[model samples]
Target: MTDRSAFPRRREALAMLAAAALPSAAHAAERRVATVDWSVLETLLALGAAPVAAPELLQFREVAVEPAVPNTITDLGLRGTVNFELLLLSRPELIYSSSFYVSSEPRLARIAPVERFSIYAPGRPPYEPAAAMMRSIGARLGRSEEAERYIADTEAEFAGLRERLKPHAVRPVIPINLGDTRHFRVFGADSMFGEVLKRLGLANAWTEATSYSAMAPVGIEALARMPDAWIALIPPVPPGALDVLAGSTFWNALPSVRAERVLQLASINPFGGLPAARRFARLLGEALPAERGHG
Candidate 1:
């Protein structure tokens, strides 16, 4: 018992001094990540882990993110052409990417522990898949709270939107990715868009099949069945393609077209990721009318 009380106070002071001298606990545990999509990068940032470099999709470079810690977000270029050397030089601890690209590229594993999740499946809806990706990413980052919060927020937003647009919820919606090839794509039961629409209490017009697939090219004749349904356009198409389609006889005859129900959306990134989920919800809200009117 020789000066034990003094020893306790001294130990506490030493601990405080050590903590003060050392970097913060948050900084000590921080991780470096490299990702393909800004959406995924944003999710990690949202979860408090920002990537040192990420692909700046030409269209999405305008996004505003502030307090911009780790400001150097390198643009590694686009799909199928990642700058491996650039990414490797950064020495990221983890690289998050879409499964499609990872499945094709073998060198990703060599750089670091690569985590693959799809955020841009061509014909796939991205909500549940994105939600699942968020969970996986959160687990990897040891941010379980973030994952739960994302899911809860998404569910809450969807529920509120559904309730607000209940009258128009029953209206059938179609997802089409118009392009030079004239790809006719629609979200299936398992797609992210499907999950959002399902959550919003809306119905998918296409019942050809459930799995994501390239729909058989439909001409004006096919529009007879559900002409009154709304058409939701996805992206990657030239800006004027919709105008071209609109002028075409095949597109002009559809009841939905005639009724002006076709809604152009900037959020058809697909691939089932968190960004897709959030964007889908916002797009759905925007696409649906605030108040249903006689059509």
Candidate 2:
């Protein structure tokens, strides 16, 4: 039989080992992170991780509505000219970015570990890359479970939207960002908006070739070609775009415009991940009933 006195010593030893295995308080406090990409920032927020700093924080607020950023977080400045001085001063434990800013990685690494994530790749589905980025960022931040849950929840949300959109599935929709009265950026099969449309069981009307941005700049005449398709314009529409187009003979001639089959959705981040996809899905669901009546 074991000695009774030795049992107390064994229990004390086990407790000490467990305590040593746990993360120290100081180490836990060092989890602060920063991001240079808005989509990355949004994904981190959705995972319940608040980045200490992010680029273009104000613009992110203007464009992205969900997964809101807190005012306490510092802005790292514009995307094209990130304030490196401010970023270094923040002393983040990690810096998240994308390949578009790969040139700055070496300099950024002087302050913290820099992890680059890509949400757009040649010949790949938009949602796939976005999901991969979410999982990767989540794992790095120790929030893998949250990432998976968010993806699953988003899929469920899309599924519900798909069911609700069944009646209007036959309506081909074209999503565009109206650049001006004369020009617009139309989304194609490779865009995040296109993926959301697919998941919602809606057909995309713009099938033209495009760069990795998955959109092409086209004129108002382009809409005439898609006569049967409804136009879903992303808002904060260029100032006076509607008023200007209203008086133009070209805009009035489109069969869709004549039928009033146009919808103005809330601002959506075309480059965002699961959160953005969910937002687009909900927007489509809300607008479909009206679209059907107009069609």
Candidate number achieving the greatest lDDT relative to the actual structure: 2
Q: Model 1: which residue pairs collide? A: 119-271, 120-271, 121-271, 125-192, 126-192, 126-272, 127-192, 130-272, 130-273, 227-256
Alpha carbon deviation, residue 25, candidate 2 (Å): 7.6
TM-score of 1: 0.79
lDDT, model 2, position 174: 94
All candidates' TM-scores? 0.79, 0.89
Model 1, position 213: C-alpha lDDT score: 34
Task: State candidate 2's TM-score.
Answer: 0.89
Looking at model 1, residue 126 earns an lDDT score of 58
lDDT string for model 1 (99-214, tens) is: 65656346878888777776545455556566777787777767878788977987888788888867875578876665443545565655666667777888877766544433
Overall local distance difference test of candidate 2: 0.83
Error of 2 at 1 (Å): 20
Residue lDDT tens for model 2, 60-125: 888988788878788989987899999988879889998778888888898898889877665455
